[model samples]
Target: MKAAEPPVPGLRQPGERPAPGPADGVSVPGVATPSSTGSTPSPAGAGIRGKRNAGALLPYLLIAPAFVAIAAVFVWPLIKTVIMSFQDVGRRELWTGDPAPWVGFEQFTNILGDGEFWDVVWRTLLFMVACVVATMGIGLFLAQAMQRMTNWVRLALTGALVAAWSLPLLVATSIFRWFADSDYGVVNMVLTKYLGLDFRGHNWWLDPKQGFLMIGAVVVWGAIPFVAITLYAALTQVPKELEEAAALDGAGAAGVFRYVTWPVIKPVFQMVATLSVIWDFNVFGQVFLMRGNKPEPEYNLLGLYSYEKAFESNSFSQGAAISLITVLLLSGVAVYYLRQLLKIGEVE
Candidate 1:
């Protein structure tokens, strides 16, 4: 080897490999080195792993606060209500420190046996259906009309909708009551003066049909803004390219909506409709205010009926039972929304 090239310092000798530098990764005996294994740096791989773990936990972290709040505000109360529903609670039991005596299923049994409860149930369902139909129909019409509006007009319309939606339930109920009040109401005055139908002193609540019509009108008016705003937003997101293509294919307005728009907005539509059903099914304020708080037996919806039973009639257990039944009845809608949420989660 020619005397090993005079053993040059910091240089490779004959048949002797140069050692790895720190940048290339110095190998420890009997240990796996990153360079030797042709793998990334441990810290880099560890950083990626940490990021993945964080991403996995992010959704739960975001929901944790809300879950805690709902548990305290709704879940605890719900559990207490369930417990109360089984007890024969009254003034004595409520005022006393002692627990109320158990009535088992007696409260539920009595309410089930009462024909008036069934009538209230039927009436609630009817009102909910009518309100949902009218709300959805008018809201959908308004949303569709908005798509064709000029930018300024759309902005003005959106502002109006927001203002309407911002109104408190009591305020909206009061406005509707004033509009349809039996004495000196705008509706009566207008009908008497302009239409000449002589509806000056009509008592709407005398006929349940007419009373529900007015109540349903108020509900629809309040509900429309939310639905219209949601649908309009959904409509805006629909692919203009697809709509144009459908039009080019000789599709009419209805056909374009059926083929291109409906699929895009169906989930939103279903959610809004379900919400309307829940709200109108448990409607109390509008009915209560419209009938001046002393709602007749015929004027009671599920919520008002429950309140009347609990406070006015002092049938606490029965009211609790009715409330529980109401929850059970609407459980289907809850399940539907839950599935929708899960489906959305899966998509994400």
Candidate 2:
């Protein structure tokens, strides 16, 4: 057959006619080219592979900075703290004590057995619940009111809320502390003069019930603004058509809010409540500054207890132990709720 046609490159004899010629878009006698898409397929395959690799690396690239920062700041410190928690700060030879000596879990055991620690734990739990419930209730009401306001009023109200949120945490704490001051505070004066109550000269921090209530009030006030703003944004996303349809069906105001409004805005409520719980549990500066970081058995939360252990008593290990416990507790809450939050839009 014409001297056997010298076998075509990358192909069998002439009957095979090679696979295809990409440029001609047909089978050829010698050239072996991909038939699909009338082009050489290898380059296209390489391009697709490169695109897949980039896609796989994109997420990591986005988060790389955060990971690096965390490792440098938080993760490293956390590891060091955990290590220090296992050491005894007291047994060291003071100036030459090598920082700390290994003491196992003695610090944790001591904290666990301390009655004050347990008391603080109970207070923190109760405080967290009260603050979350109060914040959610007020926030939902404010959000609904915001939704009904005119554009000017909405803008004004939103600005006011943002001011409250943007106020420095320490500044807010100072303002509330001054307001709650028994002798000079305007609040006590109002109570004593207007309400005819003997709130003046009262050490509110000395009384567990009143102290906890005062802290909760300040927390709820500070937190409601944030929650309201968040919920208001979510409320805007709710369809007006759905609300109108409900109204057309003779649904009352209460019915529309209870059914149509609440469900649509429920995600924001859940998110705010979850965050509120964490903030409430970690409340320190407000309560501490109010009492000057002094430990009052009645008002002490776990945070305050940890502060006392670290600074007041110089028990670094105990403080670290309490911190570890609080972190674990908060982490558990985050893990539980984050799973719920990630599933927010899944349900119809």
What would the TM-scores of all predictions be?
0.83, 0.79
Q: Please, what is the whole-model Cα lDDT of each candidate in the order they appear?
A: 0.88, 0.82
- State the lDDT of candidate 2 residue by residue for 195-219, as single tens digits: 9998878767666788778788878
The parts of candidate 1 lying over 4 Å away from their true place are 1-13, 16-65, 344-348
Highest lDDT among the candidates is held by which one?
1
Which parts of model 2 are misplaced by more than 4 Å?
Answer: 1-62, 91-99, 198-200, 345-348
In model 1, how large is the Cα lDDT of residue 59?
100
Q: Which whole-number lDDT from 0 to 100 does residue 139 have in model 1?
A: 95
Candidate 1 has a TM-score of 0.83
Candidate 1, residue 64: Cα displacement in angstroms equals: 4.6
Q: Residue 267 error for model 1, in Å?
A: 2.1
